[model samples]
Target: MKNPCIRVLATGGTIAGKAGSATRHDYRPGQIGIDDLLSEAESLGMAVTLSGVQIANIGSEDIGPAVWSPLHAATVAAVADPAVDGVIITHGTDTVEETALLLDLTLPTAKPVVMVGAMRPADAVGSDGLRNLANAVRVASDPGAAGRGVLVVMGDRVFAARDVRKVRTRGTDAFRGFPRESIGLVTPSALDWFGAPWRMGEAARFVWPDQWPEVPVLPIWAGIEPDYVTRLTGPDTRGVVVAGVGEGNMPEPVRQVLRELAVRGVAVVRASRIDEGLVDREPEDDANGFLAARALNPPKARILLQLMLASGVSVRAAMQAEFDRR
Candidate 1:
């Protein structure tokens, strides 16, 4: 491909952060603008033409429907444009997994959409943002990446949005794939293959809603009171995902509340607190009218459940089938 045109959608993160000094521990996120960030990435000279679009300049911790809705619209537009070959999203590492998974669930475009972020601020002495941004552009411009769904490029590894997670609180290689390895690897001059791309396309697509539904992730801890769970459910509560103990097991009292909620037409998904494992449905789960989260962690399950509820997909079996898609 000759000078593949890649559109960079910048949502402020550490990748755009500004600090007092190169080694300072404290810094302001999104202090740098998209033009400056993209200019730095372009300076790396990766042979790709770049265009910039600033979606938001706040940290990813504040990312919600407000940011996601517009970002989703911009991504859809970019993928549909004949002149645009691919898309790159510069997002905060803190919540990149959630955003990436949300985009993967909603978008069905054949063009590559790659998200990137950094562990250190853009102005830091050893910042990884520019390299990640450049690698994201490379992945987006690669024809082989077209049908890989949404991807997160970090630490020189390309992770499927569905499988990526932040494993460490701080570090350049904080992200990792759960229940699977990275789909591919990339450096400045080379790309290596691994697992096959796992893009579901229309089969897993969820229409971006005008307003996202209310779905909260509640963690089940020892001695947790039932009122805590009750407080989270109300007139507007569409669904809940409990990050239960091993195999998604919770104390009897909490389980009872969830069962009642499930019977009352509120969707309940039992996701595990364990870092990486399956929460397969069991006979007891069927008897309690609960759905298992399978391989989805609590946060990812929350996003998926939110999309399902917003799309008017409340049937228990249907929702369970969505979880079983892996």
Candidate 2:
């Protein structure tokens, strides 16, 4: 039988970064290209036949709709290809979770789509990029990796895109699954599973908007001024997500502004700034037409809100149903 073909789409991050010195922290991400990264992976002697496409070579921090639209389309095409068994994405760790979640919600194929990145630069000593790339290939080629939405592989751990978050800024083990344990782990010798497999709806059934709505995440702190909320509200603002403190609670002033925004037809979702927890609506929240983010973090909640608004669904109703499913 022919080896399964894995198409790696590279959207550069620290995994492709280059530093002046091995010990130096300053470096430019995406200095290396997709071909180079794939060569490193190939050196690992994985059984699968690997090919690559360079989607972008910019840091994940710069990622937005312009990049996401094309990336999503390319992913769909790759998964739909008969010869391709799975797909791997090389992304920057900064915003990889957001991109992964976006793909997971829109790309419904059962074929594995594994997202990988490195904490250290590619040229640095003790770089984890090559190993992570190889592990991503292994996961993508595994039949068991299918139907699990999108997965992030880093530091020998496998995280579901929806539940994964970047916890440590500089640690090699930067990514973690929150409000839930990691679904699996990847070792040189074996791939182990520990969580239930889940699937997403068909992409064809959902409409991809020509333009994405502007939804910004606002973090609430103690004694925050109402002007901060006032600045975000306008006709151009389609939705706003508040990264509130402790169970999605915001200052009363901020909450008042959110209610005003809701009255003006702007969708409001309350997500917790805390590392892990559900953000359900409190008594006051219900009266303000606010939607809880459930267990989703601020960034993920922002993505979900954009998607919901794009579909022309009642944002509150859509959000309610999404959390109800959990």
Best by lDDT: 1
TM-score of 1: 0.97
Tens digit of lDDT per residue, candidate 1, span 84-116? 999999999889999999999889858899999
TM-score of each: 0.97, 0.96
User: What tens digits encode model 2's per-residue C-alpha lDDT throughout 111-177?
Assistant: 8999999999987989999888888988999888987888999999999987899999987988889
Could you give the C-alpha RMSD of every candidate to the true structure, in order shown? 1.4, 1.6
What's the number of clashes in each of the models? 0, 0
Q: Which residues of candidate 1, in runs, are more than 4 Å off?
A: 198-204
Off by over 4 Å in 2: 200-205
On the 0 to 100 scale, the lDDT of residue 214 in model 2 is 89
Local distance difference test, candidate 1: 0.88
